[model samples]
Target: MTVNRRFTLAARPQGLPKDSDFLLTQDIVPPLQEGEFLIRNHYASIDPAIRGWLEPGGNYMPPVPIGDAVRASTIGVVELSRHPDFTAGQWVMGLNKVEDYSIGRGDGFTQPIDVDAVPSPTAYLSVAGAVGLTAWFGVEDVMQPAAGQTVLVSGAAGAVGSLVGQLAKRRGARVVGIAGGAEKCARLIDRYGFDQAIDYRGKDVEALSADIAAACPDGVHFVYENVGGACLDAALLNLAQGALVVICGLISEYNSAPQGARNIWQLLVKTATMRGYLISQYLDRFPEGVTAMAKLAGEGAIVYDEHVEDGIDNALPAMLRLFDGSNQGKMILKLI
Candidate 1:
């Protein structure tokens, strides 16, 4: 019998997730049935979105039932197969359970990944995968800022935020980013090519909003928001007439009680629009986004960063990095 190690959601998180919220256990691998395949997962994606599924009331997805392996998006190699469509040693990417091995039925987020196409297979989890996908649709389909317009992206040093700014810049938008610390803020201006970067650390809503106002003196035409709370509020105060606010994720409120934006009245005053979006809603156009993003990255028009943790044991800490603003880019658990 083969033993599989898994991390199950042990408890609903109270605030930011803690190690106690998960349980590590082992199970004997059952024999494969018809149309089943087993995967030896190579990497696990640690995203802020995972926190929503842990809540008792859940967000977009249903609550991860307690005792099931915590849900994650993963990339791996199929090691064994009883399914006719899959073969051993093929690379795959999908929404997978956080475990050493997973069973798949060749459907629902499960698809073969081409390992030789990019610099490495891991890019599929970062720039070429969900991270890039989210940024592409948010900027191109929703925000759609024209040349010479001003664009602002909160959580700017992160995977999605970094790409959002670059894509907007490609369209000739004057880009400004909001990050947490001096280092990340510098990276936004120096590495990602933002016209300005605002460091939000230790700053209240008033101070942050003032910084945003100074950065985009012409008023912001598009706000690609990742962090909510104060970040969203600041962008609201600086909205230009006909501004568009694209809400991707609200990391600031994901783990805690929601703090509604206080400056929403600015929307009415400026005749602006605010819309929330989900990447999954644009599945039909993923190929279009992927091709454009990969081409830009290959041509040096887009850049990205990654922060990797060494083992499954470190998954809890890696996920916490999102809330604390410690992670420099996409957070991944390197299980291989």
Candidate 2:
């Protein structure tokens, strides 16, 4: 009998989830039913969006039921199959639980991956996965920043924000990124080729807005927002005449009660548009996004960082890194 160890939601998190909120439990893996397949999970994608799913009123997806395995994206090899589309030994990536094994019915984000396509199978969870695809669609389909436009990205050192800045730069836009510290700010300008970088630490909306005005003398033409609160407020205060703000994720407010944007009024004053963007909206075009990202990655046109934690036992700590701003890049758990 296969023993499956899972990180289950022990309790609903009050604020920045504590270690008590999750419990590691084990259970026997049941036999594969007709049209079902079993996967031996190797890597688990630790994303900020998962934080929203823990709340009683979840965003997009339903709240993960208490006592169930916390929902996450995982990459693993098929260990058993009763489904025709998947066979044993094939590597797959999909929306699954953080566990030793996952049962799939070949639906909802489950797909096979070619390990040789990138540097590592984990790339599928970073550059070639949802993070990269989100950046791709957000830039190409939504923002569509033109040459000479100033594109501002918040949480610019993170997985999706970093890629968004790079993609905007490729489109001939001058990209300015806002990160937390001097180190990340330096990386934005030096490593990621950002035209300028703003360190949002210890700065209020007014101060940050002044800095943004200085960097983008004309005004910010486009905003790829990941961090909300003061970052979004500051960006709003410096928008160009017809700016477009894409709300990707609000990492700052995810763990606590919403401190809504105070400068949202600037949107109306600037005749700007602020739209909430969900990656699922572009699911039909995922293949196109993946192919494009893979090409750019293969040509060394793009660069990304992956901070992998060695074991599932370290899942809670690894996830905490996202909220504390300690994670270097896309956070992944090496479950195997």
Candidate 3:
């Protein structure tokens, strides 16, 4: 018998999640039955959205059961299979628990990796994964800014925000990023090629808005919002005529009640549009998004980073990094 290690929810989180919220345990993997396959997980994605799943109430998906393995997007090799659709050696990406092994068809977000198209398997969990798809649909489909327009992204140094900014640049739009700290601001301008960067680390809404106004002198035509709260208000106050605001996520409020956006009146006055989207809603167009991202990556037009931890034992701490803003880019747990 093979040992299958996993992390289960120990207690519901009170506020921000703590290490004590999860319990690491082991079980034996049973032999695969007809049409079944076994996966040896190599890497797992730790996303901010997973926090909502840990809560008691209904969300975009049902809350994870009290003692079940915490959910994650994992990439692994098929170690054994009795299924006609898969072989023992293929690499696949799917929604799985943070564990050493998994069984059953990983239904959602599951697909075989094309190694020739994407040279790195880990890219499936980072730039070419859900992160890139979120940025793609949010920018190319929803926001749809024209050339010479200005796109401002909140949480610009992060996984989705960084890709949004870079993709906007490639589309001939001037890009500006709002990030916390001098270091992240510099990375936005230097690494991601944003035209300007505004540091929102410790500023009040008024000050942040002023900074945004100065950076976007002509006003912003597109707002890619990964962060809500004060940043959303500031971006709203700087909207150009008929601006489009794509709400990708609200990382700033996931752990607590959100501070209301006070400047939404600007949207009314400017005749602007503000809408939210979930990537799952565009499942039919995933192939288009992934293809575009891969092409851009091959041409060296897109750059990405992954902040990976070493083992499943560190899953809780690694996940906590998303909220704390310590994770540099995409947060991942490497289980192999």
Candidate 4:
């Protein structure tokens, strides 16, 4: 008998999740039935979106049921398979749980991955993964920043925001990023090549808005918003006429009660448009996104960072890095 260790949601989190909110449990791995496969999970993708799912109603997906392994996207090798498509030793990626082993049925989110096509297997969890795809589609499809337009990105140093800035810049747009600290802001300019970077460390909404206005003196044409709350309010104050705002993720309110957008009325004043974006809506086009991102990454046309924490024991701590702004880039938990 195989014993599987699972990280389960023990209680509904209040504000940011704590260790007590989750439980580490051990269970026996049952024998595979027909059309079933077992995966030895090697990595888990730690994302801010997971915070939303911990809520009672959740955002998109249903709330993760209590006492079950926490839902997450994972990459692993098929250890055993009774499914026709999935075979032993094949690498796969999908929406799985945070556990040592996952059972797959060759349907839904499960899909095979060609490790040779990427620089690394973990790349599927970062640059060529969900966040990368989100950045690609958000900038190219939704934002569609034009040459000479001023594009503003919130949470600029994060996994998706960093890519958003770079992709918009490639379209000839002047990109400005908002990050937490001076270090991240400097990286936005020196490393990611943003036209300007604002440190929102101690600034209030009014102060941040003023800084945004100064950076985009002509007003911002496109806003790629990842962090909501003050960031969204500040961006709203600097919107150009006919500006487009794409809401990607709201990390600020994910851990707490929503404050709602205070300056959303700026849309009326500026005659601007704002739309919520979910990457799952583009699932049919993931192949297209992966191909494009892979080519750019392979040619050194794009760069990305992954902050990988080894061992499943570190999953909670690794996830906390995102909310605290301690993560260098994309967060990943190396379970293997």
How well does each candidate superpose onto the true structure, as a TM-score?
0.96, 0.99, 0.96, 0.98
Error of 4 at 105 (Å): 2.0
The regions of model 4 sitting more than 4 angstroms off are none
What's the distance in Å from true for residue 256, model 2? 1.1
Per-residue lDDT of model 4, residues 1-336, tens digit only:
999999889999999899999999999999999999999999999999998888899789999999998999899999999999999999998889989999999776678887888788888888888888999999889988889899999999999999999999999999999999889999999889999999998899999999999999999999998899999999999999999999998889888778879998999999999999888888888888988887787777888889999988888998899999999999999988
lDDT of each: 0.88, 0.93, 0.88, 0.91
In angstroms, the error of model 4 at 146 is: 1.7
Lowest summed lDDT window (length 10), candidate 2: 290-299
lDDT of 1: 0.88
How much does candidate 4 score in TM-score? 0.98
Candidate 3 structure quality by residue, lDDT tens digits, 240-315: 9999888888999888876767888998999999998998998888778878887787678889988999998999
Q: Which ten residues in a row have the lowest lDDT in candidate 3?
A: 104-113
Between which residue pairs do clashes occur in model 1?
A: none
Q: Highest TM-score: which candidate? A: 2
